[model samples]
Target: MVQRLLLAGMLSGLIVALFAFSYARVYAEPNIERAIALEEGGDHHHEEAEQGTVSRDTQRNAGLLTGLVAYCAALGGLLAIGLAFLHGRLSVRPRSAVWTLTVAGYVSLVLVPQLKYPANPPGVGSAETIGTRTEMYFIMLLASAISMAVSLWISHRMARRAGAAPSIAAGLAVFTALASLLMTMMPAISETPYDFPRALLFEFRFHAALLQLVVWGGLGVLFGQAAEYMEQSGLRVEGTARRGIPNA
Candidate 1:
């Protein structure tokens, strides 16, 4: 099971990497170039200039590919581990597992934190505050993960006491209340200049969200298929071996 899941994860990661590389190369790279141009010397000028250690070519080509693959591979491995733990809890069938995991992935990883901290293009934020911003984003992510886990536990307990429908409703209500409170309490960071192109910002965020959907959705579907195949094949082998044994 572990070996099969590991292979599935690698394959799923490759799929995500390919999709990411293509989407980023097409939609994201141009916006990034434009941002670089603005930073270098454009109308949207700021007092602080962003430093660049690497050339745009490397960033667009090798750097982007490397980062995407590494991130997706690691994410896929973690997801495989999650699926392993969730085995038999969600369902024995791969299709059911896929459906459940896809929703979980989107809600826990993408939807929650994005509501608090939306994605921005290059020119939107200040270089000096990058460290602080990164720290805050990770903190938000961690909080969101904890909130999701707690909500799931609550739902499971409630389901046993009440029923599926009521449990779902109560879980959603509690999660929403908690998430809203967190969002309200968390410090907001808005560094985008008023003059910045709203359309570009929207487009960047849209593409970013789409990228997450593609990667995670692909992982769920592909990994589920792989796991199902392995399970079925193993069962078939076992059946064949049993049939070959002499009747004693």
Candidate 2:
């Protein structure tokens, strides 16, 4: 089980890393160049001077690829642990677990706080306020995660009495109301320049959300398949042992 999980995690990480590298190269890198141009007062010489010894190729390829792969690998390992723990606890089969984990990943990690505090491109925000903004974002993230967990618990408890459909509706209502209220209550951070292109900003955010979806969705599918295979293999070995079969 452990070996299967680790292998799945590595493969998922590799896939996510490749996807991110491509997306960053095409979508993110151009915005970064534009931001640097803006920061350099649109002076080509100044932009060239400000760039340190680190080559653009190295930054785009080696740095980005290494960091992304490492980060995704860590995320995959954590996800594997989560899937293992959730096994049998959620009364879900391997396939259903994939759906559950994918939804939870998007809701808890991306959707909730993203609506409240969307991702920004380079040179969009105040450096002085970065600490405060980060703190606020994390607080909102924790709140969102807790709200989802509590809502699910409430739904499970209510299911015993009110039944599954009613309980799900009630839980979803609670989640929606609470999440909306929290979003309203949370402090807003608006740092985009007044003249910044709205279309570009929209594109950046769209790609960012898509990136999260790819990683989480990929992890769920690959990990679930590997786990199911492991389970099936274990059952086969157990059955063979029960039949007093000799090794081939």
Candidate 3:
């Protein structure tokens, strides 16, 4: 059963990857191209820069596709494992639980950290600080995930005594407090050039966030449906076995 869930997750990830890739290709790629042009100062220079390395065409097409597929697929697998662990634990239905986890995961893992350090286009940041920037982002991500877990645990504990509404409120309160503290403790990172176009920058960031939304939202819905189907099928099988009608 666990293995089946994992397979479903990976498949769902792949399906979402296609949607994500299509969105990026249509909406995000142009912004990236513009950023590259801005960084290189013109098309001529950009072409020269790309002579020995991978071409932008390849990067935007096959490269982008491959990256999204691998990323979403892995995320799907993790989602399955999470669903399995949370199964029979949450009081809500399976679909609700999956979606709730998805929302929480996105808020903690992506949205909060992004507020502190939004993703810059390819040519925006310095090469020297790339390592430092990555490390900081991961630190923020980890802190947010941990805080969310703690908050959920608190909510679960409270739910038994206080009921759902109060428990949820308490969870939200704790999460906000923890998230605020963590954001404050982390050093700020702003690498965008002053000359960079504000409109373009905002557009790129918006698309990036939207792309993530598509991935997580798609996974949540798709996997939730898959889980429901699996559950119903299992029940049917169990019923058949009980009736000694499995010969068919």
Candidate 4:
């Protein structure tokens, strides 16, 4: 069970971490494209366009990356708390605190914005566009700072059990994100021009699907935890449990 605790804690934290990184790519790609279309110095690759200049894309993507990373970090803390419960390793107060911050952070970043503006993009230019964009940046920075601290605590808690590298988890996450992006592309469906290489057939549905479902989602604790728990229980009954188990 101790080992399980360590493994679960690490896996959960990683799931959240990957989600955070995936959010960045999601925000960057389309947001950058929109910037290229809308703003003066949006496309850096274009020589006529100024490079390294901050445009709406930078603001939007920056805040988005910040906000999502923060949320995921907090979620990692929350997952750590859940791991603690499973392991009998954390106190109620500390666990509750971590869980609270996780939910609070997520709502503040992902949900609260909905109160002022809807979560999904609403075709950019409305009266709300300027102010909404401004508000998004403010929230992103605030959330990112708070979440980073919480994530650090989570990482410290899971240092031993989270044996896998963060980079590995990130790979799974980004893979899923790429799948999601392909599945949702509008340009391909509409015969509109998209510089990105994508299609409606086998490429995404099979190749991308495999990585997303097998690699990324497969590594998540939430999905695998219950099954693993049952398996461990069965093993303990069979006298195959870890050395800590008392002989029955």
Candidate 5:
């Protein structure tokens, strides 16, 4: 069962990758190009010294496709494992559960952390702080994910006594408070050049967030349908086997 779910997820991911890749190629790549141009224009010496081995065209095409494929595939596998654990636990249909999980995942893993440390296009930040920025981002992501899980557990526990609506509200409140505290406690890092185009920066971040939404939303829809079909097929098989049994 786990294996089947994993396969379904990976397949769905592969299908969704096409849409993600297209979106990135169309909306995201131009911003990256402009950012690279600005960086190269500002620092010819650095650009010459650090000439990349891969061409920009390759990076925008093959590299982008490869990255999207791998990322979505891994995300799908994780989603599959999550669905297996959550199976029959959420009281909702498989599709609803998958969509809920997808939304939660985007909020916890991407939206919350991005609010703190948004995605930056190439040549935006200093090289010296790259490691620090990465570490901080991952820390924020981890905390957000943990908080979400705990809040869900809290909601589940309280639902029995407080009723569904109140339990959900309480869970949201806890998550909001925890996320706010973490964001405040973390040291802020602003490395964007003062002279950088604000419009370009905003566009890049917006497209980055949109790209993630496309991937997660697409996965939820596709995988949910697949899961429902799988469930119905299994039931039919079981019923057929029962009918074929001996009357004794």
Candidate 6:
């Protein structure tokens, strides 16, 4: 289990970085990088960079990269390792933890700033100008939503079958999906009274991303417990089925 978890973590990391590299190459780069002065260069000018849809191939590959590397690292290190200390099982919660980190982490970095406080030059309409670039955003948009939905849904089902406390799992899933959508709406949320968590742990938009990865440390524990239960059930089911089979 230790070794498998380790392998999973490494593979997941490799994939995630590669995905980010590709994403940086495709999505994260061109749109925002164009107007560096307005964005990274510390000018709050809003420029609307135009974009289009992200094909399924790009989306799927990104998803796989995200799901595997980014996820396993946090989950394996935090959840899995922690579980061995407490209740040991390869539950699905760690999967959720991973989903949250990778998804939230990247969005906080890429989408949040651009969407809410994008740097726009005078000509927001210009292709390179800063405005609402629906085309590019949606590429990650469609892929992440679908990825979260499928993984969360599968976890929900597994949680139910395992008779585990799935409310947290279910809530996590729904919250995750909503958060993803909300992610694209960070600017709007930032404006509203609801605001956001103010504590450095949850607040401070600049470090919003750092906070995401950091908290996964605790989220890892929860995931580990869930993972333990999942492993138990899978083993149990396998044992029962084996016993039920006739002798060869």
**Which is superior by lDDT, 2 or 3?**
3
Best by lDDT: 3
Q: What is the lDDT of residue 72 in candidate 5?
A: 93
TM-score, candidate 3, is: 0.97
lDDT of 4 by residue, 11-47 (tens): 5545654554564455334544543444333345443
Query: Per-residue lDDT of 1-248 in model 5, one digit per residue for the tens?
Result: 89999999999999999999999999999999888888778546535745767777788899999999999988888888999999988787778878878988999999999999999998788898899999999999999999999999999999999999999999999999999999999899998889999999999999999999999999999999998888888888888788996433
Kindly state the number of residue pairs that clash in model 4. 0
Candidate 4, residue 159: how far the Cα is off, in Å: 36
Candidate 3 residue-pair clash tally: 0
**Going through the candidates in order, what is the number of backbone clashes in each?**
0, 0, 0, 0, 0, 24
Residue pairs in clash, model 5: none
User: What is the Cα-based lDDT of residue 89 in candidate 2?
Assistant: 73
Model 2 lDDT, residue 119, Cα: 91
TM-score of 1: 0.87
RMSD of each: 3.7, 2.3, 1.1, 15.2, 2.7, 14.9
Q: What is the TM-score of each predicted model, taking all chains together?
A: 0.87, 0.88, 0.97, 0.34, 0.93, 0.31
Ten-residue region with minimum lDDT total, candidate 4: 186-195
- The list of candidate 2 runs beyond 4 A from truth reads 43-46, 53-55, 160-163
| Reference-based lDDT, residue 182, model 4 | 30
> Any idea how many clashes model 2 has?
0
The per-residue C-alpha lDDT of model 2 at residue 41 equals: 65
Score each candidate by Cα lDDT.
0.78, 0.79, 0.93, 0.43, 0.91, 0.45
Model 3 lDDT tens row, 1-248: 89998999999999999999999999999999999999999999999999999999999999999999999999889888998898888866767877887899999999999999998997888999999999999999999999999999999999999999999999999999999999999999888888999999999999999999999999999988888888888889999999999647
- For residues 109-146, what per-residue lDDT tens digits would candidate 6 score against the true structure? 34543444432322133344223454445544555455
How would you order the candidates by TM-score, starting with the best? Answer: 3, 5, 2, 1, 4, 6
lDDT: worst 10-residue window of model 3: 89-98
Q: What lDDT does candidate 5 reach at residue 130? A: 96
Could you tell me which 10 consecutive residues in candidate 6 have the lowest summed lDDT? 189-198
